[model samples]
Target: MKKFASLLAVALLALAAVSLGTHSKATAADKLPAQVQKIKDTGVLKVGVKQDVPNFGYYDSKSGKYTGMEVEIAKKIADELGVKVEYTAVTSQTREALLDNGQTDLTIATYTINDERKANYSISNPYYYDQVGFLVNKSDNINSPKDLDGKTIGVAQGSTTKTSLEEYAKSNNLHFKYMQLGSFPELAIALRAFRIDAFSVDKSILTGYVSKNNKILDQGFDTMEYGIAAKKSNDQLTNYINGLLAQWRKDGSLQKIYDKYNLDPADADDE
Candidate 1:
């Protein structure tokens, strides 16, 4: 009877040790930064994504699902963290505000990695590269960036593309007027209606909007690096996401997602 009791005691002690270790791990996780800990505790990763841009991110009304390369990337990150995804629609103007206000943990809305953004928020390494391009009506006969001289171009508000376009014009001694639209859909309509002679933005964003009359100009400008942005204060979460992106790139998962969306993975700058 004493021997049996001794064995039971040892087993109980071993179980207690395991429980303590498990608790310790959980405690450490909870001690992480507020954003990371909240995600762990809530099992939800709130993400901001564009609802209109195709191949990057879009909501299909027919299927009632959001599907695209950026969406896929967001889902992969959530899966890696063992969390559920909750997407919030964001436009170029609203992406930064949503992240700063804690409405979203990550913004994967084809966000450009630029100097101003890096100073304001934590951004992941470029997952994709996009060159600026001009989308013009086929009837407009614009074949080059110089053709945009004295033309009114439309761009999304709160986008770095507008600044880039202006700089490109100034550097080439080409003068043009640019109108800031509220959204991408509006830009497309303006361009089609001749309200704006051209719409300048990332080439990838202009792909799905292309029609027989509207074509993406072959004149490519400087390449812009796109990155996932998080709040500047959430370093832990940003680092975790960066590490996740690194793993995905190495394992070919990122490339597969890009391919599934019909985007060339070769365009991604893993650096």
Candidate 2:
């Protein structure tokens, strides 16, 4: 009877250790920064993403799912926080507004980090680098930016493409007429209808739109640095995200995602 009682006590002690281990993990959020802990306690991470950007943040109607590099990044963040992720599709013009209005905890919608924008939000280090390129109708035989001088150029309304192009044009002694569109698909449609001579945006974005009807110009301009953005008040959360980005970049986990879609970030900085 004494021997059997001793064995039972040992088994109970082992079970207690396992329970303690589980409890430790459950309390991990208690150690996080207050802002970061607040996010984890909410049980959901609301991410603002782009539905139309393929290989970055595309939402498929048939699959009812979001797929792409940026989408996976958001999922990784949610996983780290041990929370469910909900996605809200945002456009260039609406992304910052979403952050300002507290509609999204983070905007991972290929948001380019610029001097002025950084002043208004907490932007992370550049996650992806890109440059502006143009897509023109194949029949137009538009060979270069110079070829489009004095012609109509369509850019997403809130994007920096037009201003960048204006700078490039001025230095090269060329001029372009500008048309601001609400979305990329709308810009492409306008290009197809000959309403604009060229559609310009990030080269990786242009890659998704290229078809037999249109071709991307070999020359690109303005190095664009894409980063995740949060409301100015979420400094701790942004810092937490920066830590994740640093870890992924150091471990090559980010490159693995880029490889999955055959994306080449190095080409993004081409002139």
Candidate 3:
């Protein structure tokens, strides 16, 4: 009996050792493919951006080309890396999916860094700070988010601003109908035509719209910082992008991009 018990103990110890070894090997195998290393090896940077969102990321109508502050910044990063830039238009809902599926290497869209998104993706240092605000007819009585209660709020579909509005409504128990428009241009049209009582988006974006059509709407609110997003496990890519962003901030290239569009450079705070 004593001999059998000793043998059993030895067998258990060996099994445990084998299990641990297997676990360690599996963990090492599960590490994400290094996207930055691959990009560097290939010498091409794939950037995803928005097709619309003036002064930030948008397509020029007259020029029939995509141009915005983020576009220029992305160009600079590509230039510094000495690689060709491949720009792809990405919607808010598809941004994370594209990165995870390896369709794009990085997203330069106006992605707001939040806890929920950070859990699934990596975000670089903030390139711009803007408030969550409303755009209403200049003559409308609505002035703040609180005033939005019981009013229809129009937001661009799949945007962080839309999520923020939903969260605020839930937290405050406010009852407001949220209308998700397909695009920023659609939302602008809806607000102008009174199809929705108000439109909520980034202050800078709303300001850009107002600048172009001053007689119709007014800027109403402010929010938090926005950053570029990459895949969560792509640590190498994340670090490389963060380094580039730091250099841009230090050398004032980022500010110059903001200034080129008449935006306040102070708004581009990493914090």
lDDT, model 3, position 33: 47
Worst 10 residues of 3 by lDDT: 213-222
lDDT (CA) per prediction: 0.87, 0.91, 0.77
What TM-score should be assigned to candidate 3?
0.77
Winning model by TM-score: 2
| Candidate 3 stretches greater than 4 Å from native | 1-34, 167-174, 211-222, 265-271
TM-score of every candidate relative to the true structure: 0.86, 0.90, 0.77
lDDT of 3 by residue, 25-111 (tens): 777644524665467567888889888788878877788777888888778877766678888888877777899898888898888
Clashes per candidate (backbone, < 3 Å):
0, 0, 4
CA RMSD of all predictions: 3.6, 2.5, 14.2
**In model 2, what are the clashing residue pairs, if there are any?**
none
TM-score ranking from best candidate downward: 2, 1, 3
Query: Cα deviation in Å at residue 239, candidate 3?
Result: 0.8
